[model samples]
Target: MTPDTATPSLPPTPPSRRAEFRFDGDAREYFRIWIVNLFLSVVTLGIYSAWAKVRKKRYFAGNTWVAGANFDYHGNPVSILKGRAIAVATFIVYSVVDNFFPKVGYALLLALVFAAPWLVVRTLQFNAANTSHRNVRFHFHGRYPEALAAIAPLIVWPLIGIAVGWNMSSLPASGTEFFILSMPFIAFAAVYPRVVGALKLFHVRHAAFGEARFALDLPMGDFYRIYIAAAVGAFGLLIVGMVPIALMASLSPLPGLMVAWQAVYLGVAAVFLAYTRSHVANLVFNQARMQGGVRFVSTLTTSRLAKIYFGNLLAIAVSFGLLVPWAVIRTARYRASCLALESDGEMDGVLAGVSENVGAAGDEMGELFDVDVSL
Candidate 1:
C-alpha cells in the first residue's frame, strides 16, 4: 500500500550478532593446577585421578566464554571415579577371559558389543546434562535403539571378524585360507569410515541446548564423501612421499634409507591426521545449527591445526611431558579462537528454555573414554 493508505509501520528486525567465543584460561594458572593434580593422583595411586578429571573439566568449562558468559561443568568426581572403577574392573575381567579361557573370550567380547551402544548413549546424556551455559544445561535424547543402529558397525564388525576366525584352531596352512580369514577384517576396515560418520551424527544430531535441539542433515553420503576425500589425499601424500624415497634408496645407505622411510611414514600420518581433523571440523560446524537461527562457524585451517599439533608434540617431548598442561591450554585457546557463533538473538534467551540435568550415568562413556567434544 502507498503511504496514503498504509497503516502504522512495524519496527525492523534486528541484525544478527556474531557471538564471540573466548578462552580465559591462563597456562601458568592451569599448570599450577595440573601439577597439583598430578602429584595428588600419583600420591593416591591414581584414585585421585577421578577428582583430577573433574577439576580439569571445570577449569576448561569455567574458562570458556561466549556472549559474555562462561560455561560450567557440574560433573561429580564421585560419579566419575565410580565410572572409572567400573571401566577398569571390566577391562580386568576381559583380560582374564582372554588370558585363561580363549573360547569364553567370545562371550566377553559379545558382552562388550552389547554394552557399546548403552555406554555411548549414557555418556552423551551425562556430559550434556553436566555442561551448562547461562545456568541452562544441554541435553542428549539419543535412545538405545537409535544408538544401537548408529553404533552397529563397531559391534557387528568385530562379531563378524570373530565368527570368521573362530575356527582358527591352528595357523592357516594355505594362502587361500589366510585370505579367507582376513576378509572380515578387510570389510571392517572398508566400512570403518561410515561407522565414524554414524557416531558423529548420533553425538551431534541428538544434542539439545535447551529446548532447541541441534539439527545436522549430514547424510551418510556426505560423510562418506568427506572420508573418501581425506583418504584419497592421504593416499596421494603416501605415494608422493614414497616415490622420492624409492628413487633415492640407491644413493643412500641401508640405515639411512630405513630412517628416511620411517620419517616419511610418520610425516604422512601426522599430515593426514591434521588434514582430516581440520576439514571435518570446518565441514561439521558450517553445516550444523542449534535451533534454526543459531549457527556455528569454524576458521580452522589444516596448516594451522597441523602446526599446533606438531608444536604441542615437540613441546611436550622437550619437557618430558611436564609441559603438557601448557600444551593443552595452548590447543584449547587456539581452537576457541577459531570458532564463533552467529545468532539471530541473544544466546541467553535461546538457552533459557533448555535447562536440564541428564545425570551421572549419562556420561559414563565420556568419562571412561575421555571423549571431550567441546565445540
Candidate 2:
C-alpha cells in the first residue's frame, strides 16, 4: 500500500494496417445536421446552398484524416463565392449580347461554349490551390494547352451533327440510316471523357507540388468500362421493365394504375443506378494509384452500396423528404468509410481537418471563411 507500483495502462494502439477512410461519427448524426441546414437553405432559396456548402466543407474536413494527418481547408470561402459570381455574370452578359447583337452574340456564345473546358479546368485548379495541408499547400496550375486540345474536337462535333441533320432529309427514313448517321458521333461522345481525362491527368502530373512530385495514372479502359456499364445498365433496366409493364397494363383494372406503376419503376431504377454508379466509382478510385505507386482499395461491396442507397431513400421517405439533410450526411460517411488503403495494415480511422473562420453567428452565411489542407 505504501507504493502502488502497478504499470499505467496505455490507450489501445490503432491497427498498423487499416483501410484509409476519414469519418469519426455515425452517419445519422451528420444526416440530422444536414437536414436542419437544408431546411434553412430551402426557405431562403439558393443563398442557403452557399452557407450549406461551407458547413458541409467544414464537417467533411473536420472529420477526414489521411495517413494519420488531418486535412484542412485553407481555401477562402469568399473565393468560391467570387468564382460563382463571375460565372453567373459571364452567363448573363453573354445572354444579353446574344439577344441584342444576333450574329455577333451567336459568335460570342459559340466562342464561350468552345472555351467551356478551359473554364472548368481553371475552376478546378483554383479550388485545388486553395486547399493546403500542414500549413503547406497544393496548387493547381491551369492546363490551358490540354483544355484547348480537348475543346477543339468538342467544338467541331456540333458542326458534324449539324451536317448530319442537313443531309438527313435526302436519306431514306430507315432505322439503318439513323444508326449510320449517328453512330460516329455517338462513339466520339462516348470516348471523349476518357480522352480528356487522360490529357488532364498528364497535365496535372507535371504540375508543381510542395516537397512532393504530383503524378496521376490514366486508366482509360477501366474508366470507360465503368461509364459504359452504367449506361448499359440503365438501358437494360428500361428494356426489362417494359415487358412487365405491358403485361401488368393488360391485366390491371384501372388505366391510371399503369402510370403509377411506371413512376414506381422509374424511381426504383434511379436508385439502382445511383447505387451502381457509386459502387463503380469506389472500385475505380480504389484501384487507381498516385505517384508513389500507392494504390487505393475500397471496402465498399455491392451489397453495402445498395444498403446505403436504400438507407438514404428510407430516410428521405420517413421524414416526408425533410430528412434529405440527414441522408446526405449518411451518404458522405458511407462513401468515406468505403474508401480505404489497399495495403496490409490494421485500420483505425481516417482523419480530415479544416480551418475555418466563422462569423459572429457561427453560421456559414455570416461571412464564413475557410482554409483546407488534406493529408
Candidate 3:
C-alpha cells in the first residue's frame, strides 16, 4: 500500500510516574532542637511552647519533600500564643466551676460539646492555610455543618447512654432495662464505620491544593468492612492471648500475673490500633484523587507499624524518653516511605489559588484539649 493510504497510528499514552515522599530531617539535629525547645519551654513556664511548636513544625515541614519540592509552615507564634492563652483561661474556669459548682460545670460542658464542631473546622482551616508546597498554599473549606454532621452520631450515642444511666435507679431491674442500656453501645458500633467514612469524606473532599479540590470516591461499605475485619481479628487475637495470660496467672505470683495481664492486653490493643490505622489510612489515601491526573498511593503495612510502635515503646522506656526525637524521626521516615503521588503528566501543571490567612485559635485549642482534628 502507498504510505499516504496507510492508516495513521494513534499517539502513545503518557507514562505515569510515582514519586515517593522524602524526609531529610536528621534525628540528632532534631534532638538538639527538641532539647532546646524543652529547656526554653520549662524556663518560660510553658509560655514559650507556642514558639517551640512553630519551630518543631517548621523543621518537620521544611524537611518533608514531595516531587522534589519541600513544604513550609507559615504559622505565627503570636497568634498561637493568643489561642493558647484563651484555651488555658477557658480550662481554668471550667476546672474551678467543676470543683465548686457542679451544675454550672455541666452547663459549661454542654456548651463546649456544641462548640467542638466549630473548633474542628477552624483547626483544619488553620493547619491547611499555614501549610504550603511549591509556593502554593493548601486550604481546607470544611465548614461547621459538615463537621457537625460527621460528629453528631458520636455525641448522640453517648448522650443516649448517659440519659439511660441517669435514670437507671428509677427503671426496673429486668432484661428490658439491660437491653435498653446496651442499645446505645450497639447502635454506636453499628454506625461507627459510616461516621468515620463521613468524617473522611468531609476531610478529603474539602481540601484544596491551589484551586483544585481533592476527591474521595470510596463507598462507606469499604470502611465498614475494614473496621469489621479489624475488630474480628482483634477479638481472635484477644482470645488467643488470654490463654497464655491465664496460664501465667495460674502458675506465677500476683505481681507477675499482673505484669503478664498488662503485657497481653497492651499487645492486643497495639495490634488492633495498628491494623485500623494502616488499613484505614491506606484505603483513604489510595482512593483519593486530585486534578492534573494525579492520585495517591499508600503502602502502610500493619505488621511494620506494629513493630515500630513496640520498638518505640521499648526505646522510650530504656532511654527515659530521651529517644523521643529519634522515635518521631523514624516514624515520620517510615510513613513517608510508604506514601507516593502518581501523575500522568508533570505535577507543575496544576495552577495556584489565592492564599488566605486564617486564625490559629482552633489549632491551638484543639492541641491544648487533645482533640482529634486531624485529617
Candidate 4:
C-alpha cells in the first residue's frame, strides 16, 4: 500500500437531468382496485376507508422510487385518524346548526364561506404535517399567507359563477343559455387547481427542509393546457358519441337505444377522467421540485407507472372486493414507483438530510402539541 500510494478513485456520479413523471399501471387494473376499495369503504360506512387510504398511500409511497431511493409513507395513522375526526366534527356541527337554526345557520354559513380561505390553509397544513420524507418530518406553517392569497380568487370566482348563472337564466332558452350558465363552474374548475398549486408551493416553502427547500415551478400555461385538453377531449368525445345515438333514435326504438348510448357514454367518460387525472398529476409533479440549495435526483411519472396501478386495481376487483386491504398496498406501491428526483451529481439520497419533526405522533388524547421549526 505504501509502494502504491495513489488514492483510490470514487465511483462516477450519475448525470443530472430534468425530472419526468408517469403512472405505473394500466386502466382496467386501476379501476378494479378503485372499485374494490370503493365497495369496502362504502360497506364500512367510511371507517374502514380511513385505514384503507393509509394502507394505499403507504403502498404507493413504498413502491415509488427515485434515483434508486424509495419514498416511505411514515405518516402516522393516529394523526390521520385525528384529522379525520376533526373534519367529521366540523361537518356535523355545520350540519346540525344549518338544519336546526336557519337564521343562525345562514349567518354561520356565510362566515364559513368567508373562512374558506382559512379552511383551505388548514387543510394544507394538516396534509403537510402528515406527509414526511425519510425520518424527517414536515409541517405547513404558511397557512395564513396561503389563505390571504386564495381569499380574493376563491370568493370572486364563485360570485362570478352565480352572476353568470343569473345572466344565462335571463337568456332565451337554447344550448347557448346552457353553455352560459355552466361557464362559471367551468371557470372555477380551470382556475382552482392552479391556485391550489400556487398555495401549495407557498406552503411548502414555509416548512423548512434543512438545506433543501420546496418550490413550485407551476407553468400556469401547461397547467391550463391539461384542463383545456381534458375538457375539449371529453366534450368532443361526448358530441361524437351522441351522433350515433341520434342516428339510432331515427332507425330504432329510441328508449332502449338511448339507455345503451348513455351507458357507453359514462364508460368513456370515466376513462377520459382517469387519463386526465394522470396527465395533470404528471405535469404538477414535474413542475414542483426543490429549488435554491435543494436538488431533485429523479422522478416517477403517473403515465409510465400506470401499469402497476392498473394491476393493483385489478387485484382488488378480482377478490370479490375482499382485496380492498391490498388496494392501499398497491396504490402505495404504484405511487412509490412514480417518484423521481432532482439533485447535484452525488450518490447521497434524494431526501438524505431533510428534517422529520412530524409534530406529535400519538393519538389525539388531549396532549398539548407544539411544532418546533428551529431544530
Cα lDDT over the full model 3:
0.86
For candidate 2, write residues 1-375 as lDDT tens digits: 589988999988644354467766546767767776778878976555656666676667767766676655544555555654555566678779867875566566566656555554554455455455445455555465765564455556555554565467778878799676875488566656565555555445544334344555656676567666766766676667667777777887577767766655655565555645565566456545544234466666655665666676666776798767566667677778777655433222223233232221112211222211111
**Cα TM-score per model:** 0.89, 0.67, 0.91, 0.63
The whole-model C-alpha lDDT of candidate 2 against the native structure comes to 0.57
Clashing pairs in 1: 122-362, 126-362, 126-363, 210-354, 211-354
For residues 159-237, write the lDDT of model 3, one tens digit per residue: 6665675577788778798789888899789888887888888889999999988999788899889889889998998
**In order, what lDDT does every prediction score?**
0.79, 0.57, 0.86, 0.55
Stretches of candidate 3 exceeding 4 Å from the true structure: 1-7, 161-190
Which one wins by lDDT: 1 or 4? 1
Better of 1 and 2 by lDDT: 1
RMSD of each: 3.0, 10.0, 2.7, 8.5
Q: Candidate 1: misplaced stretches above 4 Å?
A: 1-11, 177-181, 246-249, 254-260, 351-375
lDDT of 2 at 273: 54
| True-vs-predicted CA distance for residue 20, candidate 3, Å | 1.1
Q: Estimate, for each residue in 289-343, the C-alpha lDDT of model 1 and write its tens digit.
A: 9985899999888887777777777788679998898889988898899899998
> 2 or 4, which is superior by lDDT?
2
lDDT for each residue of candidate 4 in 71-183, tens digit (9 for 90 to 100): 55665556656656665666678789868875566566556556555555554444455555455445555655555674455555556654564355457877777677677
Q: Answer with 3 or 4, whichever has the higher lDDT.
A: 3
Least accurate 10 contiguous residues by lDDT in model 3: 157-166
